[model samples]
Target: MNLLLIAALIITSIAVLAYIGSMVLQSWLYSVPADKMPLRSFVTALLAGGFLTLWCWIDTKNPGRYDTLFSFSSYDTEDFDVVDAVKKVGEEEKTIRYTRRSVGTKMVYMNDQNQPFRKADAEGAIFALIVTEKDKPVRFITKLDKNGNFPPGEIQYREEGGKRYIDDTMIGRVNRPGTLKVIYVLLLNFGHFLIWTLSLWLVMNYALGHAISIACCLWLVITLLIMPVLFTKTRKQEKVITPQVSFPSVNDPNLSEPEPKDEEKKGTRQFQDSNGNGIAILWIGSAISNS
Candidate 1:
């Protein structure tokens, strides 16, 4: 019903669509085998999830909620400059100039042509933006999050001249301390980069714990040592089970042959039984015995 809500829903739907499309493409492009299904499916799902998250971000103007795209990109100079670089309408020959000014002991403002840039052509201009602080700059700056949200600050931008003086503000946000927190806040909305760092750290910590945990580490070491013993035992059993027909006697019952008296004597006095064609027998008897 609401415009913003509708926009959000649309964006979410598009994201889902993109994700499914990517999966279909992946399957069709590569003839993945069944054994590798889990790995391939995981990759496809992750990509789809990322797209869906990006869709939500575009719609909601918030990328923090989705882990998929949380670390996708980062807050670069472009993101920082978008709001600060406000251009004056109908000033092609004259380049718009802006200089930061301290309005009072606790208030500071940017002056455009030696005046506070308040009466912007809200309708005719592409955008009008101003930064406002709830507290003094020194105190507010300390409290500002890297994501560019001050404790309570306002960005007054005119999308169209005479539209409205309504300001965009982020209110009651807690101050994030230190450079790390500030950087995190700024990149908080950057879907991929922020998430990657967080995920990597979490995974590393988990892996380290597994490697260092007393019980688990001991179990791993024991298992590694035991594996070679088990393997050797298995090989020995296999060798023993395999039939060994070493030095089999010529007269053995398992050896098939015609009548012994009918056998022919070779030049070396060895008897040859023609009927013992397929028998794997070893003749250990002396040639003179039959003679």
Candidate 2:
């Protein structure tokens, strides 16, 4: 089904989107001066988060890289661990060892000699890994062995059964039943975006998309709706100019001199408001005729 190719495409798409989103978020935080966190702290935190996201993307696109890092080698059924119960009374302790065939958290890299090559284990559980050589699949198996030590590794099962060379038979280590490690490995292999189990729990109680939408709506409400309050709480009022008339004293000698008889009969107008607000309203008739 070319599942690996599909997985790669999905991982790449999400990674690019997340990277862009984080950049945008960082920019938005910078622009809001009132709600802004320290620039250095915000940048450092965001960079760390982005780096983790990038690693997750790489791991998804190339699952083999993580397998080589953590998934232990696959083993056969003959190596499955077994223990005899010593129960001589009622209510004995749980006995049978639980085993499941899946991908290993550790991966093996061969250095051209088909020998186990050294690689660091990713500090997390890994489920399935697709192994290939020259773009061809390899066969691997995960089964118990006679020694009671369940080790996962590449398998040569049914290689001589008229089958073409394939490496798709590798199996991962068996995890203990009802253990966090087991659950962690299983969830990691789900190949979906990893988040808190509590979120998944909420999704169980409520629909995933609905829960996600609610979260987004809450975020918007906080960011957009509360911005005014934030600004009001953090801001100081600035003084702004309100225009009013200012009169300048006239010192012309003509103002002090007596007028001629004909002009004396014409009365001069005084600009004033009966309300006594000290705002002068110009007597414009004289000014217009003069202009």
Candidate 3:
């Protein structure tokens, strides 16, 4: 099997989808037309995310865009010292040095390169990462400060693999990155629509009438009125998008294509309108005499 080709296709598909999704999200956030967003988004993701995707493919096992946005904190705080007993090659335990910074309540540890060692908490205990241990993952001791407590914050307790085991030791307690990303996408894209529609409905119904049915009726009308502007696509964009895994098939006779020239010749299609239209209505038993 051609794994490299497969990986490329997968990554390209994801990058395009991610770009479109993020574009729609931006539209909702910025009150821009969603259709007009894809062209620009498609260009940027293919050009920018393409290189990052390649780098990740070369350096890592999985395929994904290494977006710096979700990867880092706003800024690092002043560094503090942390001590760890890492196992040596033979049978000795050596002190591994690290610098820690507190991003909010979470303590981040960085190596000599000043880069974060643990991208995520669960990744803490990989054998490639570990004490008097041979061919085993390194073990870590609970850290304490001058006050003799575990730094008076969350432990982020590590286990066999680089995973965070919290008070609810079960894996169910931890939310996966993919799940979190989905949630964030939904909330950002549709959150404004929901907030405004509900708020307007609530206020109008309360002031005018006092019933669930009345509020629901108001909500329906408000939805239709507001949808023509914010949180909806207003017009189509005509810009050509940059490359992102598109292979046009020239030999396909069954493919359906839009005939813009024909549509344009008709202008705004009017009903009444034409014999074809009246016949279609008559066929469907909805035709009535003008008189």
Instruction: Give the top-scoring candidate (lDDT).
Output: 3
- Runs of candidate 1 with Cα error greater than 4 angstroms are 1-11, 32-181, 186-291
Task: By lDDT, rank the candidates, best first.
Answer: 3, 1, 2
lDDT of 1 at 91: 44
Worst 10 residues of 2 by lDDT: 80-89
For each candidate, give its TM-score against the true structure: 0.19, 0.17, 0.19
10 residues in a row with least lDDT, candidate 3: 167-176
Write candidate 3's Cα lDDT for 187-280 as tens digits. 4224433432343234212222222343354335433453232122212335788989966688776565756686665764553358678788
lDDT value, residue 256 of candidate 3: 58
* Position 73, candidate 3: lDDT: 27
Query: Considering summed lDDT, which 10 consecutive residues are worst modelled in model 1?
Result: 74-83
Off by over 4 Å in 2: 1-34, 38-291
Cα deviation at 59, candidate 2, in Å, is 7.8
